[model samples]
Target chain A: MVTKFRTTIAALAASTILATSAFAGELVINTDTSDPAPKAAFEQLIADFEAANPDITVKWNLFDHEGYKTSIRNFLTADAPDLANWYAGNRMLPYVNAGLFEDVSDVWEENGLNESLASAAGSMTIDGKKWGVPYTYYQWGVYYRKDIFEANGIEVPTNWDEFKAAGATLTEAGVTPITIGTKYLWTAGGVFDYLNLRTNGYDFHMALTKGEVEWTDPRVVDTMNNWKELIDAGFFLENHSSYSWQEALAPMVADDAAMYIMGNFAVAPLREAGLTDDQLGFFQFPVINPDVPLAEEAPTDTLHIPANASNKEDARKFLAFLATADVQTKINETLGQLPIHKDATVGDDKFLQAGYAMLSSTDGGIAQFFDRDAPAEMAKVGMEGFQEFMVKPDRLDAILARLEKTRQRVYK
Target chain B: MSASRASRFNQRSLAPVLFLAPAVLFFLFYVIFPIFQSIQISLYDWDGLGPKTYVGVDNYVELMDDEAFYTSLKNNVIWLVLYMLAIPAGLFIALFLNQTVFGMRLYKSLFFFPFVISQVVVGLVFTWFYDPSYGLLNVILGWFGMGPIAILGDETWVTYGIIFAGLWPQTAYCMILYITGLNAVDPEQIEAGRLDNAKGWKMLWYIILPQLKPATFIALVVTVIGALRSFDLVSIMTAGGPWGSSRVLAYYMYEKAFSEYGFRMGYGAAIAVVLFLIMMIYITFFLVKMYRDEKGL
Candidate 1:
């Protein structure tokens, strides 16, 4: 009786495998964003794709950020998704080197995504092969409370001395100059990158992330020292460590904090906190030294497919659909992120509008987010070094030396 | 007839093996095999998906010099040592409620409530409890004319604060176990100890504690394992932050394997192997005690 039951189960397993392989019917997609509106939009696109290709059915799996990372890693080692959403910068580099993601250069050309989002497409390409389409992109810069500035009679600064003077002005009025949460570590790095860009230039920033220059180098040392000076001046909120980026916004909303150096995604939260357009403002992170060449703010996001995808053709179609103006506009409207497609309609999201203007002005010089532009291993070490410097400003040399060692190990 | 009788003896012995087949298979497939696989993975350099490069002992060697690794190890030691205080603390509470009193059962249930709820809920509750502005702890501290202290933000206090939150449930669990043990304590032995003028701490140490050995053993086993397996509370509460001061070996291993950081599966497995070795030390002691008890039985 046991033998009969075992034989029946074996027969069923063989038949299921044979049926799935024979039909060429199933398409699986994985994504990280769990926002309801964006998820619903993606599902609608999936429905349209299924309708267009009667023989194919798309299986959608969406996971929140943390679980998405774990599930994607597990899936890559087992059954990979046909299409996946991933970060483009250093995040994709490890998987690309491991040959886990497919080389979709042909699809990039066939679908015209290369010409559509040339700058973003360039970042997605490594070693002259494009690995993914960029669905959305955004800029990072200073978002300050206009009401506080107005109340304090301070103008936005466009240079290093003026920025410091503004910090001084805000401090005199008993308002904290910047609200940041270094608990996550990345928030502190965002400030460091902006400072580095201002102090040296985008090229030097690129060089540091690429590990061509030691973090202990004079340029890096000067940048850290500048941040330490700001910190010593009591420029940041008191409870920065206990607050997340969102939580830090509370003091800003209450007019206790004056400015936040953040990306465009922070705009929605500002609006949700009841800040009007006139009450808020932004600026390109000031150029600290005039000798360093000026460049644009960061632009980065991702859209990619796996190498082991069973439905490669369907994945290409999905990439094309995502690159379309309609889909990009829908995503931008729902997510409050800038569309990679130039033709996509811009929403009333002021931060995203500012991002579009800033990005359009710089044609030749665009850098991805520091962490995204660099390898993940180095980014992790570098961010930790950033936090260490933030906490113990006097340990600048030690932190830089440790990061230099990590860069040496990682880059080699 | 002699040959047939020998075959019958073999068949009877095989029947007992068949009875234990399911349990043996389950343990092998789930618990035992995964441990061996983890050790095998530790020897390779794999990003989890691609071809694993054989890098024997390199991961372990690098881990030795890793500052974050050492910090995590030190933090785990602090957690284990501090977490053991729950046992004596629980015993005290158990004694307080051990007497015949009104609503004793209800009081015991309320005391055991923390153990019944999920750890995630406990973490969230404690996070609010320690919140600098709105938390109950800070509000109560304010009555003494004290300013709000950044419990989670301050690196020096973050790990200790998390351990305090952890003690909430751990003490409750130990209390319930001790209450059961207290009920089973021989009344005659207590009366004999009382007549000999043994009371208070002396009575507890010489008389009651010796009789509560089984409960104490179970409590220690659970506490040690709980301390080592403490990932969820730390993850939900601090995420090894306030400048990575709260990171334990378990949380750090998960972070290395699949966070925004590099997915160095082999490196992560090596960390797991270290954690396992640390755990095995306590597990060995527990097994020996159990073995001795079994022999005595």
Candidate 2:
């Protein structure tokens, strides 16, 4: 009787497994794009993908923005979906290393994505193989007040000396040179990325974040010293550690601050807060050393097929569809971000256009934001160090020592 | 088998055993097993995903050197000590409200409102109240021309600020508990105490205090647990910032295990084990005291 019962249960499980595999036409896509814009963008993209391939019936599962991070681990190995949206660079490293994510180099090769998605190709590749297809990205730069700059006769500060002079002028005029909220820690990272990228160059910055370079290296010290110069000059908004990135916008909105080192996403909020396009403007981060090429931070968002996916053919088709220029253009317009495809045009928004121009012309390189580029453990420890260093510049030596220790642990 | 032998397997002992079997299994599976499992996991080095490697106390060894652990331990100590203030505060409020007066029900409910509101909302409210530029705290300080203070941002003051927010709800809960206990106090004993010129402090000490022992015991148990379980306020208010100076053990464990940039399950388990050991001490003490009280009764 027990053997018969066991056989019956085994048969039931086998049948369910067979049923799931048999439904090849059903393609399940999971993504954490629950925000209004990204949700609408995916709604449009999925509708288009299904319309293009009518044989494929798409099943899209939208996850909450925060909860998806932890849930993705469970779903990947237990009940895998065909496609998942995630960030590029080291953020996807763990999954890649664990063999949970499928290699999509064939998709890149078949679709000629290497040339078109060139800017993001470097980030998407690990161990000389493409892991995913990048769909969208947004540029990070110094977003400043145009009216304040005009009033103070600041001509966008092309170099470090000019930047400092501009800041000095702003200070004399009783205006903050920069406003940032390091309360969440990543804002400090954005500042650090620009500083490090400028002071040590993009390749060096990437090497450091990847844990090849020591945190206490002389080049890193140069970056920190430059950051300390700004801190000593009192260029940052006071009490910024008390605010979130959104709360920090208040100073810029009220014209108390002139500039912010932020992503293109900040434009919409700034405009919503009553700053006209005429009043708000964007500029690339200024050059600190003439020898280093100009690098920009633009975090890429990609979609991948899980290694355990049942509908491999349909998933590949969906990825190819997502990589198309026209689709990228339309989705990015709705999402208010830049498309990965080289030929895709940015939206009509001034910030978007400016970001597109700056990124396309960048000779140095592009970096995924600090959190995405670094391992998770290192990122958390490093960002905390960055925030602490900003708030307490005297702790720089201690902070660097701690970050070095974290690097030693995380990489191993 | 003989009929007498078969009949000896009676319902008396079997019935009680059979009835409690399901509950015991559930307790073992859900409660007792997880405790051992967490302790076992604490010795391994694993991210939430992938194969776990047996590191054999390496996680604990690393935890010993972890500065965040030390900070969390210190904060937890502070939380434990300061959280005791809630018990006495609740008793005083309970005593104040125990009197018969006009429209007293409104006053009592109003005082109970903090406990009724969810902890997340309380955290958010307190977050805004401590906002450096434009919070109620800063506004009050500004009235005296002392200027703004970033309560949640300052590492030295952040844990205390969150603890105060936690205390608001905790004190109210203790007040409600005391109020319920107050209802069962013997009136004859109180009348005799009053006749013996035992009023105010003396009456409360000799007659009222001894009777409220059960309530105090429950209050002590709940408050101690609540202090150790403080995660919501810390999570919502500052997220263990500015730079993780506000992390208690529970929050630190959560940060290590589940935060966006964290997945060190082994480290998280180690932290959980430490917390569990601390809680075990309290639980064992409570059980002993409860057993003694039962024996005395």
Candidate 3:
């Protein structure tokens, strides 16, 4: 069945490419990154794709992160890209629900993508349909300065208490302990996710965001309480309200702050700041209470085709190409992210290697980041609630109550 | 003779209507049409795409119980009321600069500078100025033996801080308008009032005050609109943050329709309708006054 599906997708894309080329048609692709590696990767892909199948020129409308969101939405509702890179979780659900995205389930089955795909990526499916394809994903956790840990004679922590002690060790060294940028709000969400996942486990996080569980549940309260304890211990940087994540990265790299709980993308910036692989290391968020079921760090970021696409066959071809082991390995090596391809080879970046090991060996996947998992409206409200809790722990009940009200209005 | 007179009256009436056609068309298409569409959209449950469900008054009903919406609405009211202080403050400065002094023209131009720059840039500049550790305001405060305060981070003070930033330019705008009005301030009356011993505050109150009414009205109109339309500053400075304490209706509407969360366009339009209704109160009053004055009543 999978073989037949793959063959059908290949045939379909080939025909579309052939027909489109005969007419001098152009393809537009919208992407979120202009990073050197991805820019080069995309250009190479376009060059190769065009070389193999002449007559279809590709136009790249690349934007930075924030601009990409706005531009993509504007373009989709007006004139959309033939292929676009987007988040795969509930972030893409609205488009799917609106029938704005085309189902590429045939392409997924044909490419054998559904066979080994983890449920994390599989969660992108809505109403038993696939809207987009997985490109590259990375695990988010604490990227600690290994040298600092070594210099202070503190071992990397594997559990919650030891993590707190490690934080104390860094603090006693006059380090800010954990560097974050709450100004963007999502950084706070990253911390909150790590804490919540560690405390309440993956299923409950899903339950809470899906409105199946109350945000004021004892487990949820415990998550906030856990975060407050960290804050009370002076684990986070002071003046977090004023700094951005990139700006906060400076202190961490400077050894003034010992760790940053960030995603795999942060690896490149850390390297750019002159930190060597041997100098940095990763640890899964320490288990909270040790009684909670262990959940891996979040794996997210996907590439999908727009449903209103003009050349969906070519789009499917591209998704299959992206899923191939060879391309995945090459992209992974350059981008320093985890390849969704089961047999893809990883490169020598210690941080990437560590993240690869952690995510590959995890017991279960934590679908998407908090913001991506929840409905957009609910996530925004909930994230603000998280920030408010961080700002004033005493307001936890009020914040949860407010978010509960939003969930009722939104989900209903 | 009666037929010729009737033709003459028709031409007189038609000429003014022909002249007003373009402006009326523009206003209807751009202003009147969109407002009605927004109101209609607000009556539905839509996410900017797919099917729009007819939710009737459900959206408004939901909004009434929404603490976030109420918080935003209340904040907007506070902004509107506090933002009006700019008019009188600007008038005082204009009166200061209305005299002959050394390089008064240069001083006046410099004072008017903030009003000319874009609001986005103004928001950024003020954000830096209000930064707790490194901001200029705090640096000066530190020298005076005061400690740093997180103006944007503290929920209690953030709205007031943004309003202060907004006032800087608003006051300048009002000053320029007042200066224009003061230029035509009937100088002979000032001398007559002086002769009558109506000096200082009394002279200004009884004589000069009435003449500045036109400028005051315009300033009030602009100030009120500016306050209600204050999304750029809040978006830039705090993004309705430090616990969602700084949100006003405009920013709240934007957050609902766009941004990271789902695009709840119908709900967004509903919030926008509420904001519009509140602004309409002031807008109607201004229009009525303008209409009366137009008729020389």
Candidate 4:
């Protein structure tokens, strides 16, 4: 009886293996795009990729945005898919350093992405080698009410003095100069990035994020003082911490607030809230120090093949296809983001055109936003300190001291 | 014949053990093994995927100075103390509704509705209720010219705001438990108390209370566990935010492990071990009480 049972179990296992291997030629892709537009764009890309590659089948897995963050590490180590969607910069560094992500420099060379995807190459590269391919990125800048600026006879500011003058003019007209919401904490990080980028320049900000420079460095102090000047001018919306980024836009839509420093994703929401393109405008964050080169915050999204993937060859083919200007244009146009490939056709929307122009004109290199540039541990404490500083600028010394301690512990 | 009798004896002894094997194996693998694994993992420096380096007691040492840890610990205490209010409040509601009024069954179910919904939903509903500008709570306060208070944003009031949300469902749960317990109360015993003129508080204190001891014990156990495991509300409503002021141990452990802060597996396990030890103290006390009761019986 025992021999018969063992033989039967072996037969069942053999049949299961045979059944699974029947479809072994398929390539699996995992993505986290929970929003409707991005999800639709991803589905369209998948359909297109499948239509283009008739020999290989694609197995796609979709996950909600937050759930994917925790599940990615486990799946990468245990049951890695052919390709996974991830963010660029410090967010991808841990996986790259751990050897979980396959280096895709060959894909870059084969596709000649060096020239086509030049703007995004810096963010995707670590240790002088590119680990992933960037598909889309959006620009962050000062989005303002054009009608309000025109009505007040305020020209778009190009430097710190002019910026403050604009704020003063808006305040005199009984409008909030700048609207922000720090309840989720990352919005404050955006402001801090622009401030650091404009004050100390891009190199100093990179070094600061990588833990090479202390938070209490006088240069950082100078950045904080510049931010404090705006706070003391009573230029920002009062009780801004009570609102999320979406809620903070209410004042801007109501004409009570004049400008918001945010990402291009805010455009769709602005239009939904009854603001016309003629009523809105975009500008680069004004330069704080003429000596410091102008850098911009542009967080890019990337795709990578896991090291343990079974279909690495097919994954490479998919990535190369994704990097082409045609594929990128379709994806970005659907998702309403800037395509990484320089030759990709941009949307006819004015905002997209403005963002492309601003990015092309950036003198210094791009740095991912504060959270994406710093290690997550450091980013958490750093964003918290930024929020606290905004609320109580008098606690500058104490907050910086605490942040320095955290940086030492985290980076060590 | 003697050999056959010995085989039968052996089979009788082994039958019960064979029948119980699957459950015991499951408990060992799922519960016991993870506890020991977590204890082992706590002594290392690991980021979930990388090779672990033994860090001795460094994680614990770091946790000692961690202001966030202390804040979570203090909030846990506040949660425990305020969470006990659910029991009394539930009992009061249960007593008030224990009657033969018109549509009492409908009233009972309606009163218990909050407990039936998932905690995540309750959290979202309360988040809107406490919104600083347009929430119902503030709108009502506006009538008195009092509050446009940002409950979730203010550090001092954030923990209280979350606890109050947690209590809404927890109190309803306790009320349901007591209502079931009240159903089993002996009518003869109540009549005997009435003959002795045991009315109102006297009757409840002396007669009804002792009979409800079993229900009270269950309520205490669940309420304590619920308070310690208060993660969903904190995650959904405040995210332990306005500067980590509203964090409890469970949410803090999750934040350290899986949040954007990167996975510090060893540090996160250390936190879990500490929470487990704290919970074990209460479990031991309850077990001792249960053991004593069994012995007396």
Candidate 5:
């Protein structure tokens, strides 16, 4: 009886030692930034954060972007890290609603992030509380070949008529006007979002995405009709559905296509493809309706603390550090994206400057891209319908009707 | 006295039960338990991470009206039917390579190389080969003045493109199996058939193929299972794109469960239950055949 009692006491002591050592002063972070530049930037951020806090050690787990999406659900419930990388706005809604993400309003308040990070506050807020800290977001617009425009004697399009006229001139010159790949389907969403935002204004576009307005509404039909005009002109690269977004850039690089409507991320690839700044120019997606406000597409990436985190104090510290203007500027410089902190100064990169100006224009506030704005279920069907419409414009009615059915079912 | 002791121990021994405990426990926990659990989960409306509300067959009811479900079912049928062609094709290659010639062993290994690579690699290679602008297939067709065909982009052809990619490795696998079976063939029977003036197709059909029943059975069973579980190739090559025209049941179930398209876990479980039932039919058939064969042996 004495030996049994001794063994039990020994076992209890061993477990206590193990438990304390496992979690003491160790902050775990799970991130999904598979792209080389962003991954390097995050690694640097971690190094800086670690240097700033000598007492605390960080354990970083990096996941490939696609696999991370599926695994996040598993890890967030089973063995959540102290902090995780996620997105702002509707993408983070489900997690916030499920209480998987912790409320980090204290972090914001303690760091005085309200003024510096004010631009992204609206997106990160849920139920009158902040759920995450948005670090980076970039603008989407028309990137055109300036040399081609000059050679064709065409002016930069400011509105729908000029845009169509430019397309006609490019088509006559044997150049596809726009190069877009819809094989992965999200590229179609980019085009559809711009059209919907420009045609029906941001409120109606948000309403449609939120399923408050029917997809079959006449306003949506008007958007499709405008899109149909571009499709009918044969402006897009031929056999575009066969390529990914990167592959579609080949035509633009080769002067076979003159323009691409894409995010600011494409600037690096365009430069790598041997285009000079003089050759490439940026413009906002042309105004379809002059009276409508021009809301831009800006999908923000965020950092969040999981509700079940074991090291909440350290996680909050890291989030506060990440929200600083210096840290935000450094990271966004590496990422080639706009910083969320208002005081964070971007480098003299022309595209970054243009993106900052365009996104911050007084015409309208930012609208997250279609897939990010809508629930994922609705986005999948909506994007598929957009792709189908691009291929067969005559099927617009059928496609919109089908999307209406999915929206009703999903949002219900 | 020792003999009596040994007999008593044998009569009351728990050795056999203890020996089987680990494997039986694992089988129950990992395989048997999950199947029933999935069935239970399929009766609810759960989004994987949230509270489950029991909705009782509503997912299946919703699936009835889902056009994507019908598309997946049709594609699965196509996959199953076309996958069987691998067996005959493999046999043909095995016969062609089963000869006494210089470098014959190397030839056999070369023919078996595709099966050695992972299906994901094969899918990627075929995706590149079918690329419309800069693919080998299009390059070859260009010599004949034929234009490009976007096989993966066209809904009508995307399923066939993926299936063809899947069949490449599957056929190689069957070929290796048949070659092994041919190595164990009774040469005396072949000589006897030669003496009877049976050669070529006649000798192969009547004399040789009869000895390959076991190999044929294994090949058929694996091919059928592979066809039904053809998620990797479709996922890698096309991701059921061109408006989901190429989705098989397995891929569709995964999409419903884990994709960014909302985590409808209960709906996905229902789809999995349907796939399981379909696979169970073949499993029962295979087991019954094996049992009969065992009795015959």
Candidate 6:
């Protein structure tokens, strides 16, 4: 009895010491994972993290998707949470430059994330230092209707000419070749990104978005001319600007439209709208110029610790925990996206598998979408110009001039 | 005793100022102070995260060259002019529904229903109604062998389309005002005009209109303010889209400051200052007219 009591007491004392050694503080996290899948992913992630570290208590604040964009600016400068969610690439440049976010290169070095998250490392780096850890990303490509393609006798286009021919064939069949809603403007940006990436190569496209190349550069005009051909052929849905990205899905679902250049998230809604796997397929955005190497767009979502955070130690611990291959696998499973960790296994969902395969083979480069690659002001102006160009192809010169003027002002 | 009585008299004189101080201070703090604050902010360059840098009228200069600003300004003017139609339309509807009949209350409520609905709901309803593929508007047009006009999509018609949606609720609000005015209207004068052989249009023009002056005044003021501050509908329906053909000054300010890509607080403040200056002109005109009319009475 005496020996058993002594052993129990010793075990209790060791546990107490372990608990005390663990940073027992409230770690506040703010995130815009308000979408059902992402919300569930975060809920599970937080619960598991808490279970792993018994002494640490987490306080999570879920923010509205749209409102959080502006609210992050407010909270980061004052009354900041220990960690927050943000996007990768130039989108986080403003915060990084302002010193609102904590530099977390140490986390990357210690966790061997330099090798594990290598594909996204370039995007996370600014000034030769990693700013945040990208957790999940989804590929953007041409999501088309297999039934419509079959009906028109069109195969998946591998090059620019074939893509145009497919659109022409679909158009002849009285189906809108490409369905897009430029109402919110980012849909047009996606189309522009793919075209520019394919036409000018990823490096030139990056230079253009970074404001190093002038907007009126001949290469940009080449891209615009290519886009104009598609527009002139009436390849897009009529009155597309009147609808949102979701609303445009109606025509595609009803077989009035054939294809949409969109991200993998569209797969969910398309599935929900009753499109079977046999009816739907995704193809990489086709090559525009044979000279340019193929690149892909996969906008990444990332997490960061604020510079003003009180509990840096716990935040770093949580960052390491969140960056684990197992955690990433679980996250991407729920998020319907690709995981950043190299060893993270993706779900058997056909679209997820396809995205994983496509991204894996991409040797040229990966872009973080147009709006994310460019600064915010430039993105807004550039997308507006793209929408206008898509509608009135004749306005290309004027739009390019306006964009050039804006680039001068914005970059300055 | 004499000195004490003098002090009491002074206290009586000062009591009204003391009583008025709280409200005056609130007005200064909430309304007047913000106007100056916006003007001050307009002269600086601020992204809300970093320190503000004063650029001294540069934002205003930039606005001069901004085509989008011109577009918003032109749209605002269109809204102001087109919005005035609500008042006359409301008066006519009030005249039609003013008659005593069975179930008139139900009809009146039905007419007032649009105003009772929130602006967000109204925006959504109209957005669906104007939808190119399946909207009721297109359905009606089909029966007439007309076009499936994409009003919201066309840059030419986008502003007008948003104005039409805004007019629905404004018309209903004006109708309620006219209804209440018609209730308070002098039946004796209407009878006098009738006895003078003044028939429908003449009676409404001479007799009924004079009494509705107050209602017209209130309606005009509210409509103008509503037209100027049309941020909610623009935000909800199209988000000033179809390439920003429908943006107003208020919506432009929000886009500059609070939009996902926008945190240029100084530019937003400049826009707010411009909008406030425009509103002040009308408000001053209203105050002067009201004062003159009161003095005349």
Tell me each candidate's TM-score: 0.92, 0.95, 0.91, 0.93, 0.94, 0.95
Runs with alpha carbons beyond 4 Å of true place in candidate 6: A1-24, B1-11
Error of 5 at B115 (Å): 0.1
- Between 1 and 5, whose DockQ is larger? 1
Residue-by-residue lDDT tens digits, candidate 2, A1-412: 2243235444654454222232779998889999889999999999999999999999888889888887677667666789889999999999999899999999999999999988899999999999999999999999999999999898999999999999999999999999999888999999999999999899998899889999999999999999999999999988787899999999999989999999988988898899998999988899999999999999999999999898989999999999999999999999999999989988998888989989889999899989999998899999999888888999999999999989998887
Model 4 lDDT tens row, A28-127: 8888998888899899998999999998888888878877887687667656789999999999999999999999999999989988999888888999
Error of 1 at A37 (Å): 4.2
**Candidate with the larger TM-score of 2 and 3:** 2
DockQ of each: 0.55, 0.57, 0.37, 0.46, 0.53, 0.42
Native contact fraction per model = 0.68, 0.73, 0.48, 0.45, 0.61, 0.80
- Over 4 Å off in model 3, which ranges? A1-25, A35-37, A116-121, A253-255, A274-279, B1-15, B294-297
> Cα miss at B287, model 5 (Å)?
1.6
Compose the digit string of candidate 1's lDDT tens values, residues A127-246: 999898887777888999988998888988888888889999999999999988776778887888888887888888888888899877888888888898898988988867777787
Candidate 3 lDDT over residue span B119-228, tens digit each: 88999999989877678989999999996887988888899999999999999999999999999999899999998999889977999889899999899889998999
- Sort candidate 5 into its docking category: medium
Instruction: Categorize the docking of model 2.
Output: medium
Candidate 4 docks at the CAPRI level of: acceptable
| Candidate 1 Cα outliers beyond 4 Å, as residue runs | A1-27, A43-58, B1-12
**Candidate 1's TM-score:** 0.92
Give candidate 5 misplaced runs (Cα > 4 Å): A1-22, B2-13
What is model 1's interface RMSD? 5.2
* CA shift of A20, model 6, Å: 23
lDDT of each: 0.82, 0.91, 0.81, 0.90, 0.88, 0.91
The weakest ten consecutive residues by lDDT in model 6 chain A span A15-24
* i-RMS for every candidate: 5.2, 4.2, 6.0, 5.5, 6.5, 9.6
Question: Candidate 2: where is the Cα deviation over 4 Å?
Answer: A1-22, B1-10
The whole-model C-alpha lDDT of candidate 5 against the native structure comes to 0.88
Q: Regarding lDDT, does 1 or 4 come out ahead?
A: 4
TM-score of 4: 0.93
